[model samples]
Target: MNRKTLVLPAVVGLLAPVLAACGGSDDGGDAIVVGTTDQFVASKDAPAPLDPAIGYEAGVWNVLRQTVQTLTHIPRGGGAPAPEAAKSCAFTDTENESYRCTLRDGLTFADGTPVTPEDVKYSIQRVLDIKDESGPIGLLANIDTMETKGDKEIVFHLKTPDATFPYKLATPPAGIVQKDKYPAKSAREGFQVDGSGPYTMKPEVEGDQVTKVVFTRNPKYKGDLKVRNEKVELDLFPDAAAMGKALDDKKIDMMTRTMSPEQAQSMLAKPKDGVKLTEMPSLAISYLAFNTDDPAVKDKAVRQAIAQVIDRGAVAKSVYGSTAEPLYSLIPSGITSHTTSFYDRYGEPSATEAAKILDKAGVSTPVKFTLHYTTDHYGPATKAEFETLAKQLNASGLFQVDVKGTPWAEYRPAQMKGDYAVYGMGWFPDFPDADNYTAPFLDENNFLNSPYRSSVAENTLIPQSRREADRSAASPAFDKLQDIVAEDVPVLPVWQGKQYVASLDGLTGVEWSVNSSADLQLWELGRGRDLPEDGVQGEFEEVVLGLDVPVEGHRG
Candidate 1:
């Protein structure tokens, strides 16, 4: 939901006058600077070694999206994945069992090496081979093996039918790389980023960790995207207030990571001097993930008891202040397969029922459990949100709660390794589909380092849902899956929040740059003077070519 929520018509209306004013030079000259808090990228687990197979966060993706070329590109306004690095791609038959794509002619890396079909196969296989726990290796769970046909074609044999596979390829995790440039056995730790996308990173400046990071447009890019700026700089600050102050002083032209609910609401609803707000619908969900490996939270009764006691309504209202809506299921509301399973199971907060359930299970009163959260990444509201959670659980008197927080830099890896007893989890969708919401969290080895494994979810429900090409046909399976999650309670769904980006008045393309799922398209953005009079408002040109014949490849 990182897209502007005020509808395209409303955005167009606002941009009409803004576009005219953009012709003037009052905004900033030449380079465009975007300000963000240091937590934008995890400080310790920074997106460095930014090889697609390793990094998995907005900070890394914000740069990778502009530099890495994928097989296909999902447009700003969401729809079917369009051919990008691929000339054309499709399933071999009606089964949705196998996927194939023909590489675009003359595709070359920034280093001028040919981006052959072999590189595509290598790029994907390497990720699966490395199997980085912190990476997005699980996103490719459906892919059984990959085969390459000559230099231009590649086919993916899926373990099961998955209609959403193409959407996954469009993400950074599937970015193709030359095998020679990157190591075949392990990640090339210090390899230079030589990609075929619209931009390349500028040489790192000293103290860039606390100062800034920069990217320059890649002259070798073959895609149709218009890269207007000579440079794009991400000015990093210690906190949001400093970032905001820089934006107000015109030291930075834009600010993006995320702000506290109070800061976002105040800055966006009532813009400062030359700044404007571009708000979008977000598919991001915030929740509590239990490390079922821990003895304290391993019991389902304890999880269910805690779930029944906490009030999502009070958390949403008091902590988020209308910035977020209470979530009842893993599949967020806007997606097709979403269900109110959690809400239906636990209607309204009931401490009495929780106490009774715990007592019957031989669990004593005031069950001691620790709750972990990140200090940043989700925004300043996270502190308040977790505080509210601890307060509610402690108030129930059936549980004794302890809340602790670490910076996101440390929290993510530790949580993934099941280092926390019970922790907070937030998800920003990789794609707009419900599969993205449910599959990753419920997989055999999921984002949550929980010991609650559901064979029904892994074997039957998820597979059944992935097979159907028609999304609505898959809803029943997804519904059943949600019901199981509600009963199991490995991770308790909490809230769904909106996306907000603020920028100077003259910056064109902010509205058009955000995708349906709220991923920002940095390539689509440009400085005011360079942008077209209509901004990036017009329709995207359709991809016309289609191939009926299918080719096979050598499976490793």
Candidate 2:
């Protein structure tokens, strides 16, 4: 099937916090209830593992991040800096080489141990040196080293100047870990997670069908958003269509990130009696990447020729059916520093132009190559996109395109390693700055490595862009880098994907943020219907908390 099909949820037990009550009024009816169709994929009672290294991307870790603090955090919507685990983060130097953060005190884990700078230092260091197959070590590339200077302060020393350092630290990939709970030198020992967040992992269900994660308000969690409700329980669903059906039947209260384009369209076509739909411009773009090393795709001419043959308009219509929009550059349009380089360099998908380019390269026979795709992730339309691309390329008389498929979980590591001759990938903006878009992929040592022609981005753009503490000040450098990326066709620009959030009418504060990674902190959330306060509080009881996932919001 085309579903992501991650393993299943495991056991369910209560990881009771040392202090569960926030005074007699803590249990009052004021909890904000939210629901999503994504699953935890943890196993049975084996104690749902809490390693931030494993599969902890944007899919679910958003909640866990709110419970346990991070050095920095992108607030729910792409707004200003807000505190969750940190009190404040600021640059100590003008070059943006040195960073410092003051941690909130009186923070304690479920076991009642004080959360101090030592834990933060150890948590990040473990991800850096532990070298487990899991966790987010790749993101720690810019850091030379980090140390705890004071009980309430942690300082990060960079090997090179990088303004995005603070942004990286804010991502859920850097969620705080309990130094005493898991080994700091290797992969997390087991599922029993212990950290200081808003919630704790509860007993998991077998087959991962029904996982019970629990979230309680932290009395000391004086962050930007205060959850109206005290608890949130998440229910896992295997099928997206089935999940949509549940929302219709009210078997579930809400569905977060599990609606297919067709399903979303159908739901939008006919809104339920008490349901609402929130459509917003997501900060992600999906595209086809090329493996320049492969013989079939090795030539620069071949890659450019292929880019010219695929019709972006038709692909967007056929695959998304109006759910997504066409994209032209790595830097999304309308955003500052955006470019039309792809359009300028390759032009529209033209059969005549593509064939001419191929003929000029002296290719008599039809160029043949296999296009790899993923069966899961990014909904069900991906297959159609590939099919259309293949047909267009074949019709050009310049290509004999074949298509291959793999699951998303496998597709990610494979494509990043440049395993596919041509494959698809997506990116969610980690931050709003244009610098965030250009720096990640074209960097010399990026996971995709350097596909573009040699540029100063490696030696200059990276450090210089980072040195500018203000992203707006670094715009010119980012423009230069985008120019480089556009000229280099390691990846062809496709379409900027859109997001549709379907929820019950009672759900308030339904908004979109570029940083969808932090969408699950339900402090300002509330119901619409005129229900008793206890009724809302009862809703909170049903919603479990504590999902240990990574921040994969930028999967573009």
The candidate that achieves the highest TM-score relative to the unseen native structure: 1
- RMSD in angstroms between candidate 1 and the native structure over all alpha carbons: 6.8
* Candidate 2 structure, TM-score to reference: 0.82
| Model 2 bad stretches (over 4 Å) | 1-50, 54-56, 76-80, 131-135, 189-193, 207-214, 218-222, 363-365, 449-455, 512-518, 528-556
Clashes of each: 7, 50
Overall local distance difference test of candidate 1: 0.67
lDDT of 1 at 105: 72
Taking all chains together, each candidate's TM-score versus the true structure is 0.87, 0.82
Q: What is the lDDT of candidate 2?
A: 0.57
Q: Please, what are the lDDT tens digits per residue for candidate 2 over residues 336-395?
A: 567687777777678788778777887665877888876755555677788888988888
Poorest 10 consecutive residues by lDDT, candidate 2:
8-17
For model 2, state the Cα shift of residue 48 in Å: 9.4
